[model samples]
Target: MICRSCNQEHNNNFCPNCGEKRDVEKITLTSMMSYAFASVTNMDKGFLLNLKMLLLKPQRITSEYLNGKRKGILNPISFLILSVTLYLVVLELFKIPKKPSDISKLPSGTLETLGNMSYKAGQFIRTYLKFFWILAIIPLGLAQKLIFRKYNFTEHLAISSFIIGQATLVGIISYLILRWPLIFDPVIYIMITWMVYRVFRTNNKLDSLLLAFVVLFLFILQLILITFLIGLSQV
Candidate 1:
């Protein structure tokens, strides 16, 4: 097969030269509909391909990337970008909470800052969620580094990014179905546990569970700390 992106000849599922998936369907009405559906549903071929690999064979995907097989699907950062984009869109479209609880308890400085701003603290968080997300991943990467000492921090970061991105997607779907934000917590835990377990390929279930919960706890703590700091800035 000829690679679509690089025009190189290859006989495998992916082009050796450019890493483009082989045997891409020629455009037709059906193909167009499929594309439209995938786009609307956030399940495009690339995304679905990545998700399938991650879920069915997490270790394989992680190892493949670490071993220099970086093609044929979305990379971790790209996956995260898409997830965060969807989150921002959903947050904007829906009238969710814009004020964190205990706003009244904020110091005078923080209150003053909030008063001067056109947007609330929650609005700020929602608007620049991607930034917070990246921030949250730093500690997570560190935690994974401690647990999976075999991999470097950056490699652990790639794994963390994919896990968080996939978990966010699941959280969004859970919220849409249950119409309750809290319900998404379990969904996140479930997704993270499975993904981490598979990626690490650990034999001890306790290790995976502990790592997942620790990461979750640290992420939540970071968010709370950030929220507190944002409020304190007003004072």
Candidate 2:
């Protein structure tokens, strides 16, 4: 049979050159719906597999992905995006009110200016929270690079993405428990620390302790940077 994808001759169910299916059926509504449903099912399976591997064997999953065993598992960036999107949807579905930080200590003039500016400027920032998330990934990657000097930057990035995705899921659960804006921050930090330690398991207790401290330091640094950005925007 002639392969349509690469114009190469093949006699299999799929094109060996490009892996496109050879069973070219007529276009119909039923076919389209079936194809869409199949795609969704495959994606759902991939995501579930990724989640299970991340929870059960994070190091193995990262190593496998870095080593080019890529098929049948969700990619890190896609996973992160999906997780955050789902989290945002959950927040909206529950009508979770935004809990602003306490600014009572600031001067009345500053408060007034902030209240005025925040409504306009804050909307832009809130709408692009994903950008802030990507920005934080850089520093988080750097922290991982410092701790695991042998790994390349891209490897650190992939792992960090997966970690952030998992942390988002954990944050949703944490929110349900306390329903406080900042309450999930500590939980996320702990989740990150545990995830990283699982990925880079060490024998020495001191190494584990240091990783715990490093995760806390990174979380604190992220918090400070975000606070500074928000404060600057208020000005």
Candidate 3:
């Protein structure tokens, strides 16, 4: 018999080439539901397993993930997506008001004019949050390459992505608990420092601390520049 799908010879009850059952002509809704549920269960298991590994042994998880052992673990991109989604959901639920607008409504030569610092800071944070994942990858990838010295660039990116994802999750949770000022100030700073220390444990402890400080300083400087531009535009 010839398999209609692949135009190949078949001897079984189904098409050997395409593996389509000869008796089954159409997909049923039942089959679709079954597949959908199965997929959801598998994905949930994978994400939970990855989350456990990330919390328990982050360094080992990163190394193993980069080494191609990703069958039961969450992929870096998926991890980031899940985390950021939850973060935004929480932010909306709380109805947290964002920072003030850049341009003040005060008339010229007003003695009680408000400085643009607060509005500029808000703009800076908003921009950073939008592309935070991409920006985070730079320091993270550089850290992996510089510290490990053996992993390939792709592997470093993978590790960096995972580390950043975990840190992002932490930041989101902190924001939900403490609101904006705390989120932008001590909370993020402490979390980034802790993440750096956790990822580079094999290196000298002091060096990891120093690197974390450097990274935080650079991030703050970038924020300042973004805010300044936003403020100037409003003027």
Candidate 4:
């Protein structure tokens, strides 16, 4: 059989050249519906199992994923996306708290400009919160890729995704128990500290812990950078 994708001749269930299925199914209403349903509702991607393994051994997931382990685990970006979705659902269901005060009401002057920027930044953090959470991963990944130089930028992104995904889950739990969701910060940082240590896994415990603190600083710096950019764009 000639592979339709790469045109390599092979008689097998899948094309060895590109791994495309040998017999492509015709697009029918039933098949389309099934595909859509699976894409949306497929827990067989192993959300719970992946979450467990992610907590236990995040670094392993990053390495194994790059090594082409694609079965029974959620990809890093997908995990982050799913975590965001779950976080949003919990936020809606629980109605966590009031958002930051309206940015429109800041008093006029340089003070007002600064205040407006600050207010808008707070609003940005809360509104479209999921997108902000995802963007936070970018700076972190870039920082790790540059600083560690152990893995390439893409690998660092996978690590960052897992870190943020786990953060979102921790935030959900904090949101449930805490009256003020602002408390979510300390909890998330603690969890990420552990993740960072595990990812780097140095023999020097002190260095790893300090480096984990650096990870927290990096995230905070990214948040401020994003806010600055957003503020400037509106100005």
Models sorted by TM-score, best on top:
2, 4, 1, 3
TM-score of 1: 0.66
Per residue, candidate 4 scores C-alpha lDDT tens digits across 1-235 of: 8999999999999998899999998999999999766655665555665677677877777678778887877778888899888888887898845655665677788978888777666666677677877877888887676557888888788889988888778878887786445324677767877888887877898887787778677767876778888866656
Each prediction's whole-model lDDT (CA): 0.70, 0.74, 0.64, 0.77
Evaluate residue 61 in candidate 2 and report its C-alpha lDDT on the 0 to 100 scale: 88
Instruction: Give the runs in model 2 whose Cα sits over 4 Å from its true position.
Output: 25-45, 98-105, 108-125, 182-184
Tens-digit lDDT string for candidate 1 (21-128): 887777999989987677545643456666777777878877887889866667888777787678657756774664445545545785556653423545565556
> What pairs collide in candidate 3?
none
Model 3 C-alpha lDDT per residue in residues 169-215, reported as the tens digit of each score: 67776776777542364675676667656766655888767766665
TM accuracy, model 2: 0.80
Question: At residue 155, what lDDT does model 1 achieve?
Answer: 86
Q: Choose 1 or 3, whichever is better by lDDT.
A: 1
- For 107-182, candidate 2 gives per-residue lDDT tens digits of 6786766665555445545677666665556667778887778589888888889888887778778767766442
Q: What is the lDDT of residue 140 in candidate 4?
A: 83
Best candidate, lDDT: 4
Superposing every Cα of model 1 onto the true structure, what RMSD results?
6.0
Give the higher-TM-score candidate: 1 or 2: 2
Of the pair 2 and 3, which is ahead by lDDT? Answer: 2
Query: Per-candidate TM vs. native?
Result: 0.66, 0.80, 0.64, 0.76
